[model samples]
Target: MRMPLLCIVSAVLCLSAASGFAQGESPPAPAPSAAEAQSAKQPVFNQEQLDQMLAPIALYPDALLAQVLMAATYPGEVAEAVTWSKANPKAQGDDAVKQVAKQPWDPSVQALVAFPQVLVVLGQDPVWVQRLGDAFLAQPDDVMGAVQRLRQQAKAAGNLQSNQYQNVTVQAAPASTASSAPASTIIIQPADPQVVYVPTYNPTTSYGTWAYPASPPVYYPPSPLYYAGTALMAGLAFGTGVAIVNSLWGDCDWGRNDIDIDVNRYNNINVNNRIGNNQNTWQHNAVHRDGVPYRDNRSRQQYGRQLDGASQRAAFRGDDAQRAQARDRARASMDKAGIERPATSNRQARDQVREAQANRPRATDRQPQARSNRDNPQARQTLQNRPNNSAGRARDNAFEGVRSPARTTALADRGRTSQTLAQRPNASRAAGHAISRPSAPMRRGGGGGRR
Candidate 1:
């Protein structure tokens, strides 16, 4: 029995030794308390969080932060980063900005996330954000998915997507970046966007060209002294033409005034004389230095054509048409000859001629008187008969001649005194008395002589 018991005891002790070796191979640590676990999970920070976290590692720089803020991908983060960078000026131009850009970001929730501000403030190097965006695009399943998950986690930790928080957040944030898509989103208040106005030059059709007032035409008179040469030529032509036509045709027979004086005589004399005078004048004018035809030549040719046409028309038609054509020919001829008649003067001359012609006795009345002279033989016999007494006729002529001057003088003296008396004041009373008292001396002489 003792030997069996010994074997069992020995087996038990071996088992115990093996169990002790297995249990004591590793020492057991004490379990953590709740307060200690909580303290370990949370991090402590002050207002200078960015500097305290990123400055020591040289992971962010002021310039890179400013550039990232300027990029404005996540306006809230960008604005925050700018404030942080401005406070920590020493955190500028650090080349380690690349490493910070590689960190993960959560746009949906406010939590620790990758921000490009430090990278921008450090160098304004586009390579930092580009590198980050490339990485995210390349491994979207990993980095982007992680960020989404972290966003949800942050939401659970009191970072809710609420309107109240978003309104305040957007108000605090800057304008978004010019990128195709914004990198971060926080619930933001709808603010009226700043209006950027661009000025443009617009042309109006209403205002066209500007115009100025025109000056009126000035008038000048021909001076007797200055235009002596022209005046002399004109006078000579006119006088010569008038004298030649009048002396050749007495009292204007055969239409001398109508056809010859107005047409052949005036034109031939005036134009020939004027051309002779002005032939050398055109030589000094630049307008005629090339030996062009004179201006007067063109004018005269035009007038001649008009006159010829009018004359042809008149010859084909009758008297009425002839008169009208003659008048028109005269006007056109005057224009060609550079003759200008004042409207008033021409009218007066025409009126005077019309009055004289109107006042003359009609041919119809004069014809009968002329016929009476031819027919009346008795009237001729009476006129021719009897004044044969020479002494008697001479005595009668002497008596008439003697009585004529005395009678004329007495009548003249009487008329002057009577006119003066009639014009005087109270002359009517004096006239009455003189009429009643009648020439006393003459009356007494007449009565005594008769007695």
Candidate 2:
């Protein structure tokens, strides 16, 4: 008995030792923390992706391109401006910026209204807009560098050049005491300061040969109707001239890899004291971002902190009350300035005007009537005796297929009576059948007898 007990105890100890060894060899991993998981999921765009995003607009004139880069950072406002542009198609150039002065959009976005075609293109791919904006906000230097690289390729290919529409200039970096000289800068400016022409180009062909096979550049062509009669020769095209004086206030500060604002032009356009008197460099306004969530952790930490609770709520909920007030204020301002509010806003007034015009007989109508009377006196005499004429009988029978108001009312009344009879609790089966069945003439002819 003692030997059997010893063997069993020895086996139990051996099994316990194996279980401890197994646990020591492999332990379950702890679940990832929230921050760690989020960081892992956050998308990070590389140099190739940045190049792809910047390719389409990289060749734009310096000022316009700078404003575009700035406006892109506010995707939400860009979307709103797009909708506004579509609704108010006639509103463009300096006047348009002034008309929308009271609008609750970023100054950068407001400046884009002068180029409605650009907004139309931007609005086409909202996903691309958001991604580009996020990329710009996350990596300003990389984005600017990508633009420079693309411009160099285009310049080398002879596609980008000084033309009637735009002036392309290359500025060599000043000689440095250091071992390496700084790189040359490519600057594109509107040939005429007062008139700016937005350039449209095929990115794939314009940039000599695209380097990135994995990520091809996105090309958004301007609407043919928008740029009608403008020839696309040598992979570049220009839309109609947009006469803008002070709407464009930002310029590309390529050396610093950022946008610089012309304080005088900025002040002239952005009334209401939005910016400081001496502030020259363009800074991203978080308030105008309108609650668009920053894609990267860095941008979120940088700009997201500036938003208040109300602004955040407005971003999600559409800010209905605030928008109404803004519209009212805008209308008042436009009225004061003698700038007509967009036809979309005054739809009711337009309808009223149309109705009045339709009701009031015009001189043209009387002229047609008199001309007809002179040409066909017999018809005029026949009209005078229309009650007795065969034509009058035909005219009376013209509406024979349409039920008159009295007839329609009688039919409706009959329907209601049948419904009332059907609803009665004590109605007999025979009465219900009479109410449900159609008259003999109305019923379709079928079997003569029941089986």
Any runs in candidate 2 off by more than 4 Å, and if so which?
A: 1-43, 174-182, 306-451
Report how far residue 317 has shifted in candidate 2, in Å. Answer: 24
- Over 62-113, each residue of candidate 1 has an lDDT whose tens digit, in order, gives 1122222223223334334444544543332212122223322211101111
- lDDT: worst 10-residue window of model 1: 234-243
Model 1 reaches what TM-score against the true structure?
0.14
Residue 242's C-alpha lDDT in candidate 2? 94
TM-score of each: 0.14, 0.57
**Cα lDDT for residue 360, candidate 2:** 96
Compared with the true structure, what per-residue lDDT tens digits does model 2 show for residues 1-451?
Answer: 2679889999999898789778885544799999999777555787789888888899889999998889999999999999999999878899999888999888899999999888878988888998888888887777777788788889889898998888999997534312222287789998999999888888888998889987898788777757887866557888788999889999988667778888888778878755675678888888888878998878888897643476677667666788879989999999999986666547877886888799999898799888888679797887787676778778876654374877667777999999999887557665555445554554358765545
